[model samples]
Target: MPPDSDSPLPTDAELQILRVLWSRGPSTVRDVLEALDGDQGYTTVLKHLQIMFDKGLATRDESGRAHVYAPATGEADTQRRLVEDLRDRAFGGSPETLVMRAISSEDVTEEELSKIRALLEEADGEKDDASSA
Candidate 1:
């Protein structure tokens, strides 16, 4: 049976395809295969696209032999959903804990912290606007 409408988050392979579609726009299996530098063959990419379509994570145009595929959702939407799922599953739904853990990582740079602060300020402004509405 095909996947349900509320299917689980994309697998790593599917996320790779989504990243390609997001970066390059709609593309065919061959396009994605060429873009990805992994050992996965053409058929593997084809199967991944098909599965993504079934799972409602991707859409395809079959008017031509080489069907063009694109992500059903935007990059931010997918990222938000993935992060929410991770927060729930691994962080006990505590976003503060998640953010603290993430920021504590050595890979996070000062520039990234500044960006995060800016985003938090923006979010606070939005919340204030919504409350006054």
Candidate 2:
């Protein structure tokens, strides 16, 4: 499904599993576990998925022995909610401040810098049009 820019965001763990589901689509616990980067066990991934289902973060298709789990929410919605939450908690509810902080954050890479530049250029063009109108 396409990301919904306005949906509720999942928690960090929920986001992690959701990312896996979003990328792979309706994965079983074993599938998710194997995809995880660390030494996470199958049971552990299954446990997390169970918690996610209970939290209404995901849903399962029980057509077979291995249940296929997928996100019950939209990806874009999740990302928007997460970014907004971080803006409130970490940047005092200012997206401008959050963007500033993120750009200045140690984890930012050259690709991210290019993305920010592109977004800024897009915004600038929109503003120019609005002013001319």
Candidate 3:
């Protein structure tokens, strides 16, 4: 399903569950619990899923005996939303500030730097195209 852009961002715990759902696809509560290494009890995970559904962060299927749950948003969409929020709130809406801080804060590998450069090039190309139009 397309992401609900208005939906609130997931909490840390909810993000963990979403990561499992994103990786494993729609799965039962038990499947999610197992994927999380059973760190939290089954009931805990189940409750989180219920809350996620209410918050529109996840979708629940009740066709089978065990309800299957899936992420309401794709990983990339969620990541983008999160970064945008962070940029707006903490970086005064400056994406360049956010990106510069992020790159400086982490131990990014050469390959990742290459990828970032490529993305910058692509974005620059789009900007150039827009200016000529």
Cα lDDT of all candidates, in order?
A: 0.90, 0.81, 0.92
- lDDT by residue for model 1 (1-133), tens: 3233367789998998899999999999989998997658999999999989988899989999879998888898899889998999999999999999999999999999999999999999999999999
* lDDT digits (tens) for residues 1-133 of candidate 2: 3234443456667678898999999898888987887657778788888878776778888999889999887787677677777888998888889888779988999998999899999999999999999
Candidate No. with top lDDT: 3
Q: What are the root-mean-square deviations of the candidates from the true structure over C-alphas?
A: 2.5, 3.5, 1.7
Give the 10-residue window scoring lowest on summed lDDT in candidate 1: 1-10
TM-score of model 3 relative to the true fold?
A: 0.92
Prediction-by-prediction clash tally: 0, 0, 0
lDDT for 121 in candidate 1 is: 100
- Single out the weakest 10-residue window by summed lDDT for candidate 2: 1-10
TM accuracy, model 1: 0.89
TM-score of each: 0.89, 0.76, 0.92
In angstroms, the error of model 2 at 97 is 1.1
| Candidate 3 clash pair list | none
Counting only residues 3 or more apart in sequence or on different chains, how many pairs clash (N, Cα, C under 3 Å) in candidate 1?
0
Q: Rank by lDDT, descending?
A: 3, 1, 2
